[model samples]
Target chain A: MESILRTENLCKYFGGLKAVQDVSINVSKGIIQGIIGPNGAGKTTLFNVLTGTYNSTKGKVYFKDRNITNFKPEKVTKLGISRTFQNIKLFKNMSVLDNVKIGFHTQTKTKMLDAIFHTKTYKNDDRICEERGQELIERVGLSDLKEEFASNLAYGNQRKLEIARALAVNPDILLVDEPTAGMNHIETRNVVELLEKLNSEGLTVIIIEHDMSVIMNLCHSILVLNHGQKISEGSPEQVRRDENVIEAYLGREE
Target chain B: MMDQVFSLIQKLRAKSVYFLVLIGIFVLIFPQLTDNQYILHISIRILIYMLLASSLNMIVGYTGQYNIGQAGFYAIGAYTAAIIATRAGYSFLLILPLCGIMAASMSAFLGFPTLRLRGIFFAFTTLGFSEVVRLTILNWRTLTRGTFGIPGIPLPEIVNFQISTNNHFYYLGLFLLVVMLFISHRLINSRIGRAWVAIREDENAAKAMGVETFKYKMINLMYGTFWAGIAGGFFAYFAGYISADSFILDESFAILAMVLVGGKGTLVGPIVGAIILTILPELVREIARYRLVIFGIAILVMVHYRPQGIAGAKAEGRRIDVEKEYEAGISENAVETTAPGN
Candidate 1:
């Protein structure tokens, strides 16, 4: 598969501590890749750096063969990269419909007067956004909750809503952080299935997961990290049998 | 039967076309409804406050920034107009936009450093800034006439026709109201408006979405303040006098209350709130001292019982299904978690 994202020698520092050190990874187009490690192993920090949540202290990131190191988060999003927060960050007070509507905001070109006057172009665009939002809500299986306040939704549904919101941005690359962080085994399996389905549709997915079962089942390949460094990277079976990987997971309480 | 009614409801709920027509008809026929000078005077004041509240909504509601310095910009507009009309003898038509520009410039200056502050701190800083501007007006006796205030401000004139009557002033204010309302509508629908909403909802997420939060916020502040300035200019000429007292913290709170009581971030809510609040005092002139208490009680009840005001449609009796809302939910119960071979 052709590579869509490449990171070289990426590092992040919190004061004097090196949170993510000398990390390099490549994500190919149209694949479900997984990153798994124990707590404080820099899984999230690496996600942050790649998506421009935190500027890398050193090194470069390239997407579609263009350097995007130290770019703003929104700029990264505009460059076809989108992400979900590990802890869901949704517009809680807004309706679920409005939440998704915000995702299309970056792509919308209708003028303010158009919205106010309900001009033909504005009306058409507004209809399109609402219809598209409704379609996405249905795609995520939340069509029944279209007009409900986002904060009022059940926890599991909120996670699904986040994905729908991200999809509204029309992203080519989706970085979902902890899709099943608080889910039961069944939910985790369901999430893994969904990620697989998305990958089959020709979208690149880079998932950060803690569940070993999920990582092992969903990922075509897995990259293991320990102490901000890569300990192993291969097909799940190959990494599972690696001595370093076994020692890394067994030696640490995490 | 339900389908026809639903279609009608949907048409009304759509929020754009018909609402414009309704407001347009109301504005045009407003003169025929009442010829009372007191009513005219209050109508003009309502228009001014509506502009203030609408712009304030952009910041406090849309951008999620707490700002109490609207009066500072209001004063800036008043002072700018007072200076020009008195010293330069400029016409009201010409002075209107100039005052707006001056207020916008001053707002940008105030908003630049303070945009970093959030919540109550931001609110307090703006309050402090307003007091400082008030003090400056009080001390700068040479230009402002200090505490005594500037008097004999000229009314807006067309050719040799000065708008001397309250009816004429009402028309002028209505004209300004329409213009400012148009601008507000335009600004809110633009990319700048979306950025403001994103910032209002989640600043970090908005930044992640590639919106320049600070810049949009500054624009929000400037636009709101600029309109406030124009309103102040109108007040200066309409009242035929002005002083530091006219642009006090009470004035700030009153306009803020108007927006909040009406529903912040909504276009017509502020206008409705401003009109009701402005006209209430006059209606209760018999026991003038009790008017504020009555207004306070009404606001309190409105806030507690109907927090969304007229503009907040969802706050009413509608129940929206949470399941079909956003596709953000999943069930952990259905997936069977099995080990590698189980």
Candidate 2:
């Protein structure tokens, strides 16, 4: 399979501290890869660098063969990369549907004048977008709450809604940061299943998750990070039994 | 059964069309009820303020930028119109656009840097700016005539016609208000409107959504201030006088209060607010000073009870029609998949 994203020694720093230092991992096309590490292992920071949420301190990031080391977040999104924040960032006061609609704004090309007049073209495109938004909402099983305030959604549904929102951008690769952070086991299982389903559709997914079971079960390949550096990379079974991985998780062994 | 009842309810609601028609007829016949030029003047003032409040609401309400220097733009407009008509001896038609440009340019200049600050900080900065503009007008005695103000400002003379009386200006004001209201309605329903709402709801998210946050914000400020300037010019010409005291912080606060009390983001809310508040003191002319006290009390009570105001809370709330359209689409599939036979 072709590599969809490649990072070469991607580094990010905070003053004297290196949050992500001399770390690199390749994500192949249509694979669900997981970056697993304990708290402060820089999994989220690495994800940020990939999605252009933060500019890299050094090194290069290539998305679909194009080196995009320091593009802004929206520019990165327009280039077919999207992400969901660890803490939910939905437009809270807006309806769930509107929150989803905003993601599709990148795909829309209607002129301002068309929107002003509610012209035939504008109305037609708007109707199509509305339909597409509704479809995505249904696929995530939150169509029933489309008109509910985003702030009012159940925690699990909100996470699912975030995925649906990311998908609305029609991205080639999705960088999800801790989708199951606050979810219960059953919700976590639901999310794993959803990610698997999305991956089956040929959508490339890279997840940063702390849950060992979720990482081992859903991800085809696992990359382990310790102190902002990659320590191990291989299949789930290979990395799971690695000595460095064990040392990273346990800090010290008997 | 529910659908049937809902359709029937919709039919009953349609009866409001006839009620609105009756009101339209009454409004047409209203001025004939009293030939009092004072009443005509009051009506025209209310209409002008309604237009101003609605325009100002676009910036403060939809874009989530609090501008307490709205009166500064108003002053810019009034002075531009006054100077052009009086000193340069320009035609009324020519001076209006010049006034708009002057106000818009000043608004963009102020909005560019200060928009970097958020919430209360932005509000206070604008308040300070209004004070600066007022002091400039006051101390620039040679240009603005200081507190002496401008006098004998010519009434707008059209082709072979002069709007020299309250009635003539009433028609002129009415025409402008209608044109402004139409433009506002179009603007708030457009892509720029969505950009404003997005910024208001979440500035970071708006930028992340590829919205040019600063550029759109400047545009919002420019549009709002441009209209306000024109309305201020209308006020100067109508009153046949211009002064710094008339366009003060109190007036800015009054307009802000109007938008808030009427529901900030709702299209008709500010108009309703301005009309009621502008005409309110006339009924209490006996205790005119108490008018401010009463207005203050009313605003406090309204905020405490209904912060959402008369029309709606946020822009999304007022857009029930769009939400319902989206909801309908969502419901069809959800109901279909969840239920085999519906």
**Separate DockQ for every predicted complex:** 0.25, 0.15
Interface RMSD of each: 8.0, 13.0
* lDDT, each prediction: 0.79, 0.80
**Chain A TM-score per candidate?**
0.94, 0.97
Pick out the ten consecutive residues of candidate 1 chain B with the lowest summed lDDT. Answer: B333-342
TM-score of 1: 0.81
What proportion of the true contacts does each candidate reproduce? 0.31, 0.23
* Model 2 error, position B163 (Å): 3.5
What is candidate 1's CAPRI-style docking category based on DockQ? acceptable
Residue B251 displacement in candidate 2 (angstroms): 1.6
lDDT of 2 by residue, A8-29 (tens): 9999886666778899888999
- Cα deviation of B155, candidate 1, in Å: 1.3
Candidate 1 RMSD to the correct structure: 6.8
